[model samples]
Target: MDSNKRRHVGHRRDNTVLPLAAGVAVVAASCLTLFVKALLKRNSKPTQKQGKGREGGSAPKSPGAGAYVRGMREREYVRLIPDVEMLSLQSLLRRIQKARGWQFRDDAARDQAWARVLATAQSAAGGAWPLDFTPNDVTPEQLQALCDAVEAEFLGGLLAEQVRRAGRPRIRVVLGVDPRDPYSWLSGLHEDNTIFVNSNRWREEVSQDNPLVFEGALCRSKLEALAHTLGHELTHAVVLNFFPAMDASSPAYTPDDKHGPVFMWLNRRLFGHVGHASKRLFNT
Candidate 1:
């Protein structure tokens, strides 16, 4: 009887230990399989072109501009410009005063007041117009023309530089206003994307009574305002190409959210004091 009892106890112990051991082994094997699968997935994925270097990895080398240009072709690209409505000097002054929250007695008085504002603001801002910058004067039937010229001359030059650096892709500019909202303004995608500029804000902020104040500098002149807007939009375009992956991953990507150190670095690199000055002047 004593021997039988000892044998029964031993059998029970073995059964319990064997199942527990088997379960632990199965769990360990499952965990190992999952880890191996994840490792393989990570290794098999293609790497991005730019961020890898900063992330402690190297990119595959390709031929010169030919290869770079070929790679760009796979990406989509577009440019957008909002249309402008030409207003008479009287109409323009009234619109400007309204946008600025300035009270004027009449249209004629507003026009005279705006003229003085423009001259004084331009002198204060300290830059040559039409060369260092271009201004769009609000005149009947000429607003669109001015916008076109700026897009072609100023923005065109900036885009051309980008194309030379990154190689050209399909680019187009969309034009119009957001009917539902009046306070809308220009925006751009840093990579192949569109730029939106608000005509109303441009006119209002560039006015004498209500000059757009940025970084302690005032943008009163039309040219200065245009330059400021162009610089901002161009920065967006450049970053879109240089840091495509950053956009894809970050949830902080928005019109108001600054693109962090990358944007500051590029701005400092490209424009130097002028970029600094513009950033100051526009408060961007």
Candidate 2:
């Protein structure tokens, strides 16, 4: 695919924070902490009731089971765990106040939070983990593969559940660098599934190095952030594709509620986070 049409170039801003970069910091800290505990919980022997569902190691029941007809027979589900960076425990706690829309509120019990998190981990197990990349730069082939993985992990699964779909929800992703825009990335949906990430910033992160004490740790964080970006913009693209009617093309197009209950449900279905399933429940 041609690089320009496949990806977008994000305009640079002096101080605006992009969701892919800022949001993952909060998400990886909170959710991944809970995920470790979940792994332990999963390890502790399974009971008869829990084992019933996994009696045959079968694929989970499809939400769109009966309605979906054959179009593209690519049923290989590839789950990706984006290489989002980790935030300090203290940082996560501090950001908790800003998480106004969390699935469970601050006053809610910790066990409740744990339960929801465990469910997410279980759902993600069948999915594939994301490919690790150097912090410095991504080759054209790598960029294309990243886009394909995003489709398989997030968009493809949702597409499979649809009843009346044409050939398939066409999508692709590419990269771009725009100086002056603080945003890390943007999704172009009018034509195809293309994600334009800030190349300048991406390169900066790649060339950036921390102290000797914290070498690879920071690199891992950069990868996490990128993966989160893929998961995110791909989700947005799928929603836009599935319900273009929800988009406002009129003069008053700005006045619409695309991020309502339906959008949340879509996230839950695709990323396995129902209600408000993101690591960063809200933007601070």
Using Cα atoms with residue i matched to residue i, what is each candidate's TM-score against the true structure? 0.36, 0.36
The total of clashing pairs for model 1 equals: 12
Q: Cα RMSDs of all predictions?
A: 19.1, 34.5
Model 2 CA lDDT for position 210: 29
Whole-model lDDT values for every prediction: 0.40, 0.38
Cand. 1 Cα-lDDT: 0.40
Scored against the true structure, residue 71 in model 2 reaches a CA lDDT of 22
**Against the true structure, candidate 2 has what lDDT?**
0.38
Displacement of residue 271 (Cα, Å) in model 1 is 3.6
**For candidate 1, what is the TM-score?**
0.36
Candidate 2 residue spans exceeding 4 A from truth: 1-136, 155-169, 178-190, 203-220, 249-261, 272-284
